[model samples]
Target: MTNTKTNYLFFTGKGGVGKTSLACATAVEMVDAGKVVLLVSTDPASNLKDVLESPVDENIKAIKGTNNLFAINIDPENSAEEYRNRVTQPLEGVASKGEIKKVREDLSGACTTEIASFDEFSRFVSGETEGTEFDVIVFDTAPTGHTLRLLELPAAWSSFTEENPEGASCLGPTSALKSGKERYHTVVNRLRDGSLTSFYIVARADKASLKEASRTSNELKELGMGNQQLYINGVFKAIDKQDSLANEIEAKGSEQLKSIPGNLNELPIRTFPLLPYNILGIDKLRSLFNPDLQKSISESTVAQTNTPHQELTGIEKLAEELCENQQHGLIMTMGKGGVGKTIAASAIAVLLAKKGHEVLLTTTDPAAHIQDFIQQLGELPATLQVERIDPKVETQRYTEKVLEHKGQGQSEEAKKLILEDLKSPCTEEVAVFHAFSKAISMAKRKFVIMDTAPTGHTLLLLDTAGSYHRDIMRNNMNAGRLRTPYMSLQDQELSKIILVSLPETTPMREAGSLQDDLKRAGIKPYAWLINQSLTLLSSITDPLLKSRASAEAEVINTIKTSYSEKTFGIPFIADTRLLPTLLGNKEKV
Candidate 1:
């Protein structure tokens, strides 16, 4: 039987879920089927070139040995520039001289960057571009939250246009929406049509990623995006039955796997075995996508073993710790990219709220899915307030205020330069730090849970504290007037850091580094939460899983020893961690 499906696939989930690898594998599969395929990555950190083992850049490049396969990384900034020109070109003739300049400035905002990228994305989805002849088009997306926002932009932009029917042209709102109506409608229609698009929530076979996928799936469904398939990647199968460590790990993994949560179980679940080799190059990806090849590889390498170890029940330990002291402070979750920091943070927030603490859950992570996760909570108690910090908005407000203080007569070029400087990563850190300070202030009254950015970003944010301190000292009297009241608070008394990690080697190592970094900055963690360990609660049966579990035990011991007893572990949950209804049945302590 011939498969006649028009493949327009989007891979999204929590960060670090192997979306890029899966997208590459799927595209390679289509290419091997003698079909033309285009793999496009919309992620800022596009690893398509790394995965394909080719030097592909912003433009489309054909993969070697694959006649029908091509890949491209869509540069959002370049797309935004082109879009700005296109929008302004027609307005030049109709708009008055002064109006044209103003329109150009308005279009230069950060929103323009987002709109431009969405426009490029829409062209592919709507089949409006020259390369629309491909039999399949796969998008290797960023994390779930950003991708969803990008997908929903057409509707948002449409609403904005409708509200201000006059185009935001130099002509002072006199420009008609009719001018852009055709293009706008085309993009909106493409996004809404399920027949033309399908999404796969790619995830690791761990509690946090699985929970995030389930939550993201529900949010997308509510947003009218079609239900997504659940692609569970990195599943470890037993290769050696005699190895106790291996068996113990697999047994634990199996327990979690068998108990697939309610929200996730209904979706078509596809499993990919854990591979010894990194899925970076195209050949490896091609091999990974081949069913027969993968099956043979999995069978040959699978190990079964069990090991003895003391386990730490994460939630129980956490509950006990929290109950011992109902002190108000901040619990910040920090980690590397794609390591489930946001989900871990959200889980902490939910648990604290359930325990009757007035909690304000917030995140400074540039790519956070906190909102999506919280929406699944379904009517949280009045004491729980979940909010997201938009760095862009904060930066914009800061920029405008500074400009107002600088006052008029600045040349357009100078103004543009100033705005660009304000949009720099450094400025973003400052803006986020200002907000962080305010949130920390609120912890004096209630529990504040922060889902911090990735390690590098968090370091930059905390560095701002020192810089602000220096700036304040330099301008003593003036500093007092400019400084926010929140900046004066000490970190130790107001905040408690929580390092979150999985049982895997990479995550644990990263978490350790995060702790060291925070400690060096004089920020000691109150506790550490090791998330999604099968070995923590059950015996493993797969050799590889057992080894992994053993490794985790070592890490856990290290954490316990190093942190002096402020470490906890949250075991893998069988069911999806979506709605309260789904997660209501608490696991036995």
Candidate 2:
């Protein structure tokens, strides 16, 4: 009933929660139902091209697999370049070269990229881009932290420009705030309208995803985006009560579902069953709503999917390696969200601390799910401390710190310009990066285990850090060389990035892409972790689950061979909180 009514749809949650698949499936469902649909992805690291099996780019083109369906990826880099060129090309004759260069610099970095994407999103939502042609527009947004910020930008900038009439902060040194404020408010209103838009907070029935979903729901509620629903993906129930792994998996989900977090319990929820195979490709996407129509998996098919590779035991060997010859260093668990980064990081932190070393466990997640693990740890006798690098808190602190120091020797006008620029949300990104640097610096004294935000937001922070490194290097070229945050991250001995992902094609590929990005930035990952692997569980279970385990063997070997020099695997143990189990299953092993 609601699908026919709402023209705008938002599928947003923590990463790896099947947002893209669900969104694409919904768009296709709508299209097959005879409504022309336009699906748009706002993720920096989108896999739309792979999922849709089409050559998708920034241009709004027809998706080949389905009729009456169109799609586009809001390529942030391209959009940022276009926006900068569009705004500055007109000033070629009007402004000096140095002035123009400075203007471009102000409009550069992740800030401008975000601004460009927001502009594109606003255009589509406000019916200015491909609106007349499509009956519905589906927005596959970035992970939770990034998407929340993107959604809040319209209201944020609108209020910023309204109260500070002459402020030129949002557009940096250049001021386009006057022209965009009305449109920004219009987009915000369009989003807030329940009749036109529907926001689906998608998540798996786990602590990390649900808590993040709850936080997102409350925040969106505060923003007056009350047209929201919870989409619980991969829900499981045990048909065979004797199967321990299956029973545990089902029980874990059932227990969590019994007590839904925050105001999420208030929202209407739509649950999807846990599928044996991932909803990959166009055919699988089309089968999402009608799973009974999907092809049956034969034993031969399962056998074909299985590989000869044996699964790595657990985090035991990996934690032991981390402790060897390294009493104090940085260990960052970076991954697509919902692939169990939170649990893996927490487990590693606990293990390290239990090994008689002081461990400072922190997270860059805006939701701060790390804080929730404190109760689960239940009085850690080992020196384990948890903290969160809150964006808002850090932004405020950075603003004051800069105002105090930068304003010391500057003239009144220079100080005011600094103050003006600090008012923009761009400053917030810098603040978060500063917090990340501080967290990295702590590694010198103790084992600093950092659980980062989902891939997109973490990449954004790192990109900001790279910009930071370049800026400092340029300014202090002739002066004494100080180690930048990026430089510290690049040092293999100083930092060990643990690339985490599930043993699946898309998640592993995304992790691989992240690893490539890190390599390009001169940061080598210390190890790779294939989390929540179903391989090695020979327990008699459902045919579907058996096939899934067989499927994991291939990806596990791929990750062990192609991804990292030091590879570790964690089995899918479904204890409360989904915490790490030393061995996958003692009896089975």
Candidate 3:
């Protein structure tokens, strides 16, 4: 128990695996034990406000009911703005206004946003807090891919500085970090040193999440931070014999638990049962960390009332609209990871193809699960075709194409530097954006359904698209060439963005933020699809299931009142074979 409250604790895993809930619970427990604690979230789509049931901004504020706990949300936009001002202020007197404007523009990029946010992270981890009074700091990180890159940044920057001390890479001049080298070095040491810092890999009793956690653990170890602990959340057990859905869920969870990746078997592991009620507010949050409370927590169930749950529209209606419109455009399913985007995308594609429309279902996500969806459906309509833009493959092709086409007349020295620069993560981003652009063109002729990566990565990719569009507009100035994929995406009639969310606090907030981001980029979404909703599964009468259903109803009402005008609910099903029938289409492929 003492080891859990290390000086620095990081809660990381795939998205939607209860990282924020567990991290918040740990903070409440430490505060109750009389330790000064600071809890922060670095995820761009943070739900700290929803979890704390209070407003949380960039500044640290004390939790109302806690003795010694404070919280902060390090937002990327705010951090990037501050970082840009900090880096450009000193040059105001030396450089011209035009030069200053160029510097600001360069710093206002996707790569810069990531670097700026990470700068704040390094400072916090290196003990740069103004008070220095907190005994422990806990961080709820973003998804696996984003967090892995964040953990690897110190080493990446160290290598960049060593190789090009006199020049700048994608981040900035190496001299920008002159004064903070020692601080960053200390932060790196704290991260790798087990006594000074602890990393906890939180996951669920599901095959995909367990595999992702195993990969994350191995990657962290390769970065010289080997010591870690694993927590398997949402373990289920059936108490009612006649509850078929509950029994099936229990069986699936048990099977996945037994088959956890072999590499994670050596680490200290813990499992938590699925509580009967949502873990909201301070009392429920704190109960998760106390062993005695956990022993009796599962027995605590929600008391049902006479209120009837609302009956919402389902995906079948959305499918009917697409079929009747007979339009050829882009349909994109996006939200946080593990929120059923792939399933929704595949289902829509199947529906459209069954109606005799040409549909190409492709994905730009590195960890694509479209193949699994196709396998589940067993077959696809002849009009439907599937593809994926493998990042590794596209990067190699993009590099060779650039070397042969753009690097033909360059000097040998220049060519060497070009090759070196092309090896960066930024290069991969550019290549993938081009692949995405190509995919967009296919929508003009046929329906293009894309299942994007997780929220953070997908946003980054879109950021790249924005950047590329600006470059083309500034350089080419031709109307024909100025209309890029970003332009096509912004056309409301040409692209329909479908946001998928779970009936939980974190996923709802994240989906709203994602919708806001899309709107900011000049794109408006078509609808919000609440996937795997429990309220729609009214046949399940078990106490645990009923409690979850009631909790889900509240979130659904919020979604209906606040967000999209068109909101659809998908019922939780024990067997996915009933999907075609659920969609109001019985065309077997």
**TM-score, per-candidate, Cα-based:** 0.59, 0.91, 0.92
How many residue pairs clash (N, CA or C atoms closer than 3 angstroms) in each of the candidate models, in the order given?
37, 0, 0
Candidate 3 local lDDT, residue 580: 51
Most accurate candidate by TM-score: 3
- State the C-alpha lDDT per candidate: 0.66, 0.80, 0.80
Report model 1's TM-score to 2 decimal places: 0.59
Q: Model 2: what TM-score?
A: 0.91
Q: List ranges where model 2 is wrong by over 4 Å.
A: 1-3, 90-103, 130-132, 162-170, 173-179, 295-309, 403-421, 477-480, 580-589
Kindly indicate the candidate among 2 and 3 with the higher TM-score: 3
For each candidate in turn, give its C-alpha RMSD to the true structure in angstroms.
10.1, 3.2, 3.0
Q: Which ranking of candidates, highest TM-score first?
A: 3, 2, 1
Write the number of the candidate with greater lDDT, choosing between 1 and 3.
3
Candidate 1 local lDDT, 14-66, one digit each (tens): 77778878888888877777898888887644557767888777777888867
Per-residue alpha-carbon lDDT of candidate 2 for residues 1-589, written as tens digits (9 for 90 to 100): 2255888999998788889988998988888888888999999889888788887889888888788888999988777787788777778889999888767766666787787778777888877773348889999999888898899898977776775666453354234322467788789998999988999999998877788898889888888999999999989766557788788888888888988985988899889887767676677787778755554533345445543335575676677888798889889999887777777788888888888998999998786677666566557745888888988999999999999998998899888878876878788887888889888888989999999888877887888888777667656865355888888899888788999989888889889999998899889998888887767555546555676777787788788778877887776677874553433342332
- The runs of at least 3 residues in candidate 3 whose Cα sits more than 4 Å from the true structure, single-residue gaps closed, are 93-96, 166-169, 177-180, 291-301, 305-309, 576-589
Residue 558 lDDT, candidate 3, scale 0-100: 91
Name the lDDT value of residue 117 in candidate 1.
68
